[model samples]
Target: MDPLYDRLARELRECIVTGVYGAGERLPGVRTLSRTRGVSVATVLAAYRRLEDDVLIEARPRSGYYVRNRPTKAIPAPARSAPAAQPSPVTGQELVLSLVKASNDPAVVQFGAAVPDPSFLPVRTVERALARAARQHRNRAAAYAFPPGLPELRRQIARRMSAYGCATGADDVVITNGCQEALVLALRAVTRPGDVVAIESPTFYGLLQALDSLQLEALEIPTDPVDGLSLEALQLALERWPVRACIATPNFSNPLGYCMSESRKRRLLTLLGARGVPLIEDDIYGDLGFGPRRPPPCLALSEGTGAEVLYCASFSKTLSPGLRVGWLVPGHHQARVEYLKYVLNMASPTVPQLALADVLHSGGYERHLRTVRSDYARAVGRMIEAVTRHFPAGTRITQPAGGFVVWVELAPQVDSLRLAQLARAEGVSIAPGPIFSATQKYRNFMRLSCACPWHSDVETALARLGTLTANLSIG
Candidate 1:
């Protein structure tokens, strides 16, 4: 269905939920709604059909659609994190190792991977773009493309970055394999072995892995479920320890999805600048925001502040992840990052760059973003609703403003690793909380990915997880 119809469906869903149209009330006729909303009759019908699929409304044989009589449950977000202020080396790796293995298993209902399904991607468009790019650039398709990547792709990226308040040209953007490689390059540019880097308590495991690979110590900072990394904790940590750098995901961080306010972003920049510690920002989830406008990356606010923030992002989330395309905007470390890029893999693939540039230049990616973002919002809502209904009371889940992943904090009596083991026995997979912490904190928490296409099996998997959690709590 067109994104236009999805927007219409979302608006109607809100109206019904907010009691603008009471339960069992008949909705306007498709033709009438189409006329009123300035959309085609087909669009309105599609919208209604979608709502019916979601069981939000029902279609009568001789009557128009009516709202379903399902009661809404209020689920609360998790409390703020208060991890130990001291920096610690990543200790155990068993939980992440198990999650990594589960993520690739075909039989397990996949919630372990923090990635959207193929249904969320623009498969045909991307294929067409790739084919066209290879045909058009037949001469350069096989070449290395070298450091800083293809100029045209960088140019298109630079253009998109302008909307989010980042001021940069093609010269500043260095393409990498994905956001992971971008992050590795950023960490390398700023910190050395044994350097203490501050991070969110329940952070992305990938970041922890990178820090471990570089032999960097991680100072897990206190993070709010609503706000992002705590500046006060970071300030105190800076004062207490010899912190070398800070890494964060201010916009829709993994596991715990929360976008830092603009004021906080500026304050964070100033705070880091004062301490002479650079910030390696993971903006991978920046484009997936369920808002009117994309939140500005800290790099956007760092333009004139002289605060060095290594901005990293990728098309993996918004576009095709298989392409392995990502870029970085290293403020002062551009030269070193590009050199590291040269040393690591020589350069990113040439064809994907050309293809992405083609897709961006065509201007269809934004439309694609609208569809995926709405689909994720809908999917996340359903997943949260299922958790509330199936899981025990006192369960606190993160209410993400963007991104498909959410953090669930279960009762202290429940151990996420044990829950994960039990859920896997039932052919379900999840990222247990212990994997997200350097000091093995959040043992009772787990992060779930709502990127899968909703279906009965997926619903069953969540139910099984809830059952396992209940069993674990009892044990």
Candidate 2:
């Protein structure tokens, strides 16, 4: 028994998903849809708005709505992860460095880094914004910005945060160099050296590196590829060890694209509050959700519950990463995080902050996001199809709901590091799974980037990767 609006929305969503309306094809006007479907104009409009919120449709001023390009075939998502449950010392720095160096080489087809292709970014729009910012505020651009960052940028971030269900004002937001610095400040705010922190198994390599640099112990928790962190496992770890803090990307996690359920988020917040531990949430990829609404973060659910969730995010994933503009909502630990940020580097670059602020204020950022979301979804779909066609029979992959990376698990006989080396020699780059874990598990796993548009070169590289995997398996 869905409501009238819900029913209408669902029906129309199915039509869009099933290609009843193809990409860039216009849908029936409000009046026409109302008459044809025997529903009120208001109902049709509501349904359209729901679709727009999901990034499934776009409304033109007088031209009606159009179908957004999205993945048609549903790739089966990866299964729940099972990593060693004990706390272990972080390693693999050399491997990470080597992989990063290789992934950055222009000679290779990059399926290793989790970065979006430059073509996917709004370069012209951003350049125009930057020029305007420099001309309008020459003095401001030249001066050094202090820790809390530009007021206009913070205000814009606060406005965007409300859309994601986190209620906060400009005064509560602290800008940093990027999400990386925000995460570092958050880690410093909550944990001491040698303290144990619980993290998702097969988590982002960058997080593992951060833990290693800060001399912290990692307790890997089993995580599902679709549902995100295993709350049951987290509770068990909390009971067994003296976990000082926890970090996770609850909405569209990196490597393994998954968003945690809202119910589970509430329960996790409650559990952390009861244990008097803080949770550092990385929401950099939250805006890329391919669904109707952005998944709410843990901080939104923990409001007024006395549970601390240090929220970190950036425009790098959705906008220009080169600008290095990001922010942190430090919950109750705002003062400490602000201080750490001040001591860490004084402040982020002023020119880029001003440029980004102008972009956000002019409403250009949102428009750009809509375009890229569609592009990324289409690219991911193509990657999934290519993988299915070329990989071995037992290959399993993650069909991410959002974000631009896919995790693939091959037969146990294939070693990812060796495969990575072979792929590198063939001018194809990939992120081996062993680097993602402190224990160097997932020897047969690798993460591939789906940020680039489909092209013959990418297709050829994927086929070669599959061949390399098969050859290694035989060896």
Candidate 3:
């Protein structure tokens, strides 16, 4: 109905499949085709059109179209049976831990490690507060804080969280050394080793490290580049596996920088809640969003009777990673999680806890976060601009709403591991894609850290990487 080429293309497509021309055979000349088929030369052209459209044949200049060796569609018989897929028995912990240790080497620019530049942290503000708090409560510093965290600090957290619509109280908070310990304690309280847990396909490596240490099994769900894990795939996993809990990052996720949509968030929570599955949410980067305010936490979404979400976060990403001050809002699992925290670490260090409390209560911490957020936004933008100028064609970079990590997909020819080694040899370290994936699927992907100031040298390094990729092309 549209044109002769369209109809001819369809006819040629079927003719190719029906074996009018055998494999490795050249098709008849266009004029001969017109005479044999008794159709216009245009109709013959249209038939060959369909063949090329379906990739069944190729045309050569100075030569006619030739039949390709591609196999035609055939019925696929069912297999007799296949073994069920279980988690891989091998442990990736040592490999990852070694990489983590090596990434911090001074010779490396340390893009692999996600820590912010030390120069950017609010050291002076923290020090002043520590001095004032130490003099005021020197005796209390020696005494142990309560197991549920210091009341004043908890109140500050609750007030801040309440601004985002999360209804929490100091009575429901459990403080731990860092988000790592909080996550581990929550996992310990809710699940045991060998318990199946749903995780995003390319999730935070630290969480993988945690699951390895705890001996939990992971079922990776396919996730989007901008949003998080697919709800349909997750529902399928829930129907298939006995998933005890789910671990996700609804805010700017590490390595991916995806923010799950509010609609998807509600659907995810309700779907998982219905299955009686608990959610272990990591919100460490929530406060670092490039926008005015971070998205709401899953703990805030909890309602009466089915509060299965366990929210965990730390000030490390914002104020200081060394402080190691983090908390858990364990909806419905508060008491059990607190007991686990006590048995695990006794309590977080008293000096840092009170110092954090003093700084937060006095209103210096939020100001520091605002400053850091502004700096980080610039850093992320500069990195993205550098990537667009330097990366290969067909390359797409993640434009995170917040956080300083950018995920890059290189052309398939460039192996990230190889690129990583090359970058390392050149005095820069990068996070390879395999570590983020349980199946190591993203062989050509890499992550760059934008926490450092964007310097000419960094841009030059990216250009060098692009050159390296282009040189390695087989073409």
Best by lDDT: 1
Rank order by lDDT, top first?
1, 2, 3
Model 3: ten consecutive residues of lowest lDDT = 74-83
Q: How close to the true structure is residue 290 of candidate 1, measured as C-alpha lDDT?
A: 84
lDDT accuracy of residue 218 in candidate 1 = 96
- CA deviation > 4 Å runs, candidate 2: 1-16, 21-76
Per-candidate TM-scores read 0.93, 0.86, 0.78
* Candidate-wise lDDT, in order: 0.88, 0.86, 0.75
lDDT (10s digit) by residue, model 3, range 1-475: 2356655555665566568877778988899978876779888877776565334677889999898764243212111111123343224434466556755676566667788877568888888777877888899888887688788888888888888888788887888888988888878878888888788767777888788788888778777767677788889888988888888988988877778777778888898888999989999999888776678877777674363888899998888888899999887778888788787767887788888888888888887776677667657766765666666666767777788898877777778877777777787777887777655656677788888644556667778877776665543
lDDT of 1 by residue, 79-111 (tens): 889898788999776567777677667788888
Q: What is candidate 3's TM-score against the reference?
A: 0.78
Candidate 2, 280-311: lDDT as tens digits: 99999988988868789887888766688899
- Model with the higher lDDT, candidate 1 or 3: 1
